[model samples]
Target: MTDYEKFKIRHNVITLGKKEYDIAIDKFVRKALKNKDVVSIYKIGSIRYPGLSDIDLIVFLKDRPKHFSIKKFSIKNLSAKEKYMFMHEIFAVPDSMGGKIKLLYPIFSLEHLGGKKYDFIEPETSDFIPFFIQEYVKGYMSWPDRIIRKGIIDEREIIPQVYATKYSIGIYQKILGYSSKEFERKCRQYIKVAENLREDFYKTKKDERDKIIIDLIYLTKEINNAMFFDLKKYLDKNIKTKPRTITLYLGFRPNIVVFNKHIDYMEFLNIRFLPSNFSLICKKDLSGAFNDEKLEKAFEKRYKLIEQYDDFIYKNNLGRFMMLTNMKSQFNITSFIKKRVSKN
Candidate 1:
C-alpha cells in the first residue's frame, strides 16, 4: 500500500514506471490458493490501467459455494466504505502478463468459454464489439419496439446498459478483426436501430422524448471517447444522428408509472421506485455509465415467467440445491429452467 511498494512494476526493470502491485496481488492470491476450493483469482479494472488505493480481486472457486459472499457486510465493526464494499462484494481486477484476454484480466473459473462469462460484466473489462452487437440487438432493439408498440414510452427507461453501435463495430474490427459476415450483420443491425430511432422520434413530440434521445446521444459519445483512442475513425458514420431541429427545451422524464407495491403474494412488475443509480449492478461501478433499472426492466417481460420459475424453485428446493452445488450467485434459475424445458 505504500508508494514505492505499489509502483515498482518489476523486480529490477526501472523504466516500466510505477506498478508495485504484484506483491500485494500475490499475497491475496496465495491466501485464496491455500484454499482447495479456490481454482483461480483474477485481478481486473483500474489497477490494470493505473495503480490505485483499492485493488479488485475475482476469486473463482473450483466449485461454487452455496453461500458465496464475495465479501460480507459488517455494519457492526466496519467503516461506511468497508460496509459498502462488503455488501456489494466487489474488488479491483489485477493485470496479467499477456494473452488473448491479457487486457481482459478476468479470473476464469468457467474456463471452457475462455473468459466469456466475464463479458457479462458489461461496459467493463473490455469493449468486445461482437458481444455489444448481440446485446443491442437484444436490448436496444427491444426498447423502442416495446414502448412504441405498447404506447408505454415515458419517463421509465427500458434498458440500463447504453452503448452505441458504431463504437462496438469499431472495437470488433480492431481487436477481433472483421469478417465479411460480421461486418454485413453489424451494418444491418445498425440500420434497424436507426430505423427504430427515427420512427420513434417522429411519432412523439421532440420535447417529450428529449431525455431518451439525449440518452442515446450521450452514451454513444461517452463510450466511444472512453473506449476508442481513434474516436473519429471508429465513429458510426452509418448511423446518422438526426435529432429534430425543435428548440432545445427543458427535457422532462417519461410518465412515471409506479407499480402497485402492495403485492398479495405475487409481485406485479413495474419500475423499481428507488432513485436510479448509474452503476451497472448495485454499485459495481467498473461497468462505467450503465444503470441497473433498464437492464432489469429489459428482461421484466421475460420474468413474467418468474411465476412458473418461483414454483419451480420451491418445488425443487433450489435454495438448498444452490447451497449443495456451490452455485452461489452465478445461477439464473429462470433462464436455467427455460433452457431445460425447451431441451426436454
Candidate 2:
C-alpha cells in the first residue's frame, strides 16, 4: 500500500470509530473552498494529530472582502453558537500579504491588518529600516516553514502536504511565536514554584500553615494560567498530585540538585517552606514506609534537639525560625553530599 493509505489505515485503527470525523473534515474543506474569496482551508488541532481529540479547521481568505461573510454559508446541523465561533475563527486572518500567506491564527485573531510597518523614529535616511526590514522578512518567511514541517505535519505526507500544510505552520508560529528559549525560561520559573510548594508542605505543621500553603497553591494556578503552555499536560500525564494541590506540586524542585555557585540557592530557600512530600524531605522515604524503629529513632533525635534548644525558642517565639534554619541546613548538606558522590 502507498504511504498515505498506510497512514490513513493506521489512523483509523488508532481512532477506532472516529473515522467519520476525518471524512467530515475533508468535506468541510471542500465546502469552504467553494466560496469565491476562500483561498484555502487547512485542518489543524486534533484532526491533524491523528489519534487526538477535537478538530480545528483554518479557512484562509485572500483578502477581507467587504461582501464576504461566514454567516452567509449554509453548513447544516451547527447551532448558532457554533456558527458564530466558526465565523469568528475565519475573521481572525491577518491582513498583511505575508501574514495571509503564512496563515498564523491563535486562540484570538490578529488585531493589526495593515502589515507591520516600520516607524521612522528618527529621520527618513536612518539605517534602522534596513535592519527592521531584514528581521521582519526573515521572520515572515522562516516561521511558516518551521511550523508546517516541525509542528504539525506528519513525516510521511510532508511532500504532498507541503503546499496545503504551509498555512498550518504559519498559523502555529504566529500563535506560539518563535522563542523556545523564552518558553523554557518561563517553564523553569513555574517549575520552581511547584518545587517550593512541595518543600513547604514537608516542613510546615499541617494545621498551623493552612493559610500560607493555600496562598502558594493559588499562586501556582496563577502561574499556570500565565504560562499557558503544555507543561501542565506534562505534569498531568507523568505525575500524581491532587487537582487542588496540582498548582503547588506540578513542578516541584528537582529531586536532586547538583551543587553549583550559580544556582539561586536563596530563591530555593524562600520557596522551600511551601510544603512537599516526605520523599522530598527525607531520603529514607524512598525505600518504604517509616517503620516503628525508624520512627522511634526520628522522635528520639527530635526530642534531643528540642531539649537542647526549647528554652531559647520559648523565650523568643523562635519555633518557626529554628525549623526553617534546620530545614535549610539539612537541604544544603544533603545537596552537597549528593554532588560529591555524583562526581566520584
Candidate 3:
C-alpha cells in the first residue's frame, strides 16, 4: 500500500478504538459537572500524544466537609467494564507525570476520587492539574532538543548501527567475561542487528522500537554487572582482612560500612559518581550527603553487591536506590573504620 493509504488505515483504527473511551470520559465529565462539586476534567497522558494508545482523565473535585465526604470515591455508578477501563487510566498518572506530585501531597490524599465512587470530594489544596500540564508542555517542547543533545546526531537523521555495536561491546566488557576477540565479533553483530531494527522502527515495519529498548536495557544491565565486579576486585585487593563481612545494601536504604581510612579516598581520587538517577542517597545518620559522598558510597555498594551475587544489586541498579544519611556531619566513622579495618 502507498504511505498515505497506510497512514489512513492506522488513523482509522485509532479513531475507532477511541470511540468508547471518549464516550465514557464525556459521560463522566458531564456527570461530575452536574454535581456542582467537580470544577475541571484535565485530560493527561497519551490522550495528548499525537498517536495515543489510551486516554487519561484527571477530574478535579471541590473540597467538602470531612464528615460528609465519601471515603472511597469511584465510578461504580458506571458499568463494571467502564469502571475497569477508567481505573486503568487513573493509576498510571503518577508514573507518567514523573512522580513530581508526590513531593507536594500524599498519594493517598487523592484516594477519595477513586475510593468513594460517585460521592467523592476533591482535595482542598491541589493545583496539580495546572502544574502537570505545564511540566508536560515543557517536556514536549524540549523533546527535539533533548534528542539532539545526546551528541549522537546533529539533525533528525537515522542513527547508524555502529553506535549500538560500540554500546554492545562496552556491555560485554562490563558484564560478560568475553575476551577482546569475542567482544569485537559480538559488537559487530550487534551493530548489524541494531541497524536493521532502526530501519524497521522508522518504517513502522513491525513495532521494533520496544524490542530495541528491551535489548538496550539488557545490555545496560550487563555493563552494570561488569562495573560492580571490577569494583569488588579492587576492594578485595585493597582491603586486608580475613572474613571481612561486607554487606552491599541496595535500594533506597541508608546504610554503609566503610573503613575509616577510605573516608578521604574519594577526595583523594577526585572522581564524581551518581548513585541512582531516581532518588538521592545519603549516609546513615549524616544530614547532608555531598554528591561525592553519595557517588563513592554508590560505587562501593555496587562493587560489594556484584562480588556477593549477580542479582544482589539488580533492583537498586535499576535506578531507584536512595541513600539516607548526612555525610557532612562532625561524626567521624570514616577514620574509625579505616583504622579498625587496616589493623585486620
Candidate 4:
C-alpha cells in the first residue's frame, strides 16, 4: 500500500468510536488468527481500561518471518537495541520521557514468540530501583516540564499528561509486586486526581483553566519530589558508592546543587545511574536533607520485599554489552553503506 493511503487508514481507525473500534479490533483479531504462524493474540493497554484512544496488541508468532525484516521476530531472541528500536517504532511516546502516550493507528502491535503477554520477561527484583526511578522520578515528574519550567500550558495537553502519569504509576506498582488491593488503593488516588483535573480543565473558564492546571501540576510535583527524596535516601544506604554523595539538580540542563554549594562543573561522574538531571555530592552534605517519615517508611517496606529474592542481578553489564553490539550491527559504517547501495 502507498504510504499516504496507509496514513489515511490509520487516521480513520484512530477516530473510530466505541462501537467502530470494537469492530476494528474483532476484524484485526480475525486476520491475526488466520496466520498459521500466529499463536496467541492479546489485546492490551488503554483499550482494556475502556479507553478508545488506540489499540495495543501482543502478537506471538511461531518463528521469524522473512529475512532482516522488522515485521516478525521471537521476543526471546531480540537484542536490547532491537527491542528498544522496536518499541520506539511501534509506540507513540515523545522524546521527553514522561510525555503523553499516543499510539499510531490503525494498530500498534508487537510480534513475539516464547514471550509473556507483555512481550517481555518480568523485571528482576534488582530492577525495582531503576524501574521505580525511571517511571516515577523521570516519567511521572517530567510530565509538567512545559508548564512548570515555563508558563506555557496547552489546554489540549493537560488531560493526556495526567492520564499518562496515572497509568505510569499504576503500571510500576503492579510490576514491582504491589498487592492487587494496595495497587488499587495507591492508584485510585491518582485516578481521581486525573479525573478531577480533566473535568476541571474542560468545564472551567479559559481564564481559570491555567490556574487549575498549575495547581494540579504543583501538587503532583510535590508528591514526586517526596518519592524522589526517599528514593535517594534508599540509594545512599543500599547502593555502594565510592565517595558518599548525593547530587540535586535545578534546571533542565540542570545545574548541580550539593548541600548549599552550587557547583558549576558540567563534566562530572554521576554516582548513581540516575537521569542526567542529577549530580553527585558528599553524603555528609545531605545528612539531614530528607525527613519524610511516611515516604521513608513506605520506601523501606518496598525495599524489604525486593530483598526476599535470592538471585539478584544488580548491574546489568551483559545487557548493556548486548545493546551496544546490536546498535553497532545496525548502525555501523558497513551497514549504512549497504543500505545506501541497496537504495541506489
C-alpha TM-score for every candidate? 0.28, 0.26, 0.29, 0.44
Candidate 2 differs from the real structure by a C-alpha RMSD in angstroms, to one decimal, of 26.7
Query: Model 2, poorest ten-residue lDDT window?
Result: 4-13
Index of the highest-lDDT prediction: 4
Per residue, candidate 1 scores C-alpha lDDT tens digits across 105-192 of 1222222211213333323323333223223222333333333334432231221122235545544455435445644564456545
Q: 115, model 2: CA deviation in Å?
A: 23
Best by TM-score, which number? 4
State each model's C-alpha RMSD to the native: 19.1, 26.7, 17.8, 14.0
Each candidate's clash count: 19, 15, 20, 3
| Predicted candidate 2 versus true structure: per-residue lDDT over 225-340, tens digit per residue | 33233423422443333222112222232222111222354534533443321112222221222233443243233333323333433343333321211211124434654565
Clash pairs of candidate 4? 244-283, 245-281, 247-279
Over 209-324, each residue of candidate 4 has an lDDT whose tens digit, in order, gives: 45555566665665455445545555556532434233344333222223222222332233222333322222233333344344333334333332311111112111211110
- What lDDT score goes with residue 281 in model 4? 25
Instruction: Tell me model 1's lDDT, rounded to 2 decimals.
Output: 0.31
User: Candidate 1 vs candidate 4: which has greater TM-score?
Assistant: 4
Q: Per-residue lDDT tens digits of candidate 3, residues 1-344?
A: 11221111121212224556667777766665555444444454332211123334554433321211122234555676565445433321111122233322213222222312332323222222211111212222222233323423211122222232343344334333354565456555666665565434445533344435335434433433333344345344433342312222221221122322223445322212222111111234222222234434433443332232213122213112111111212234446445655776
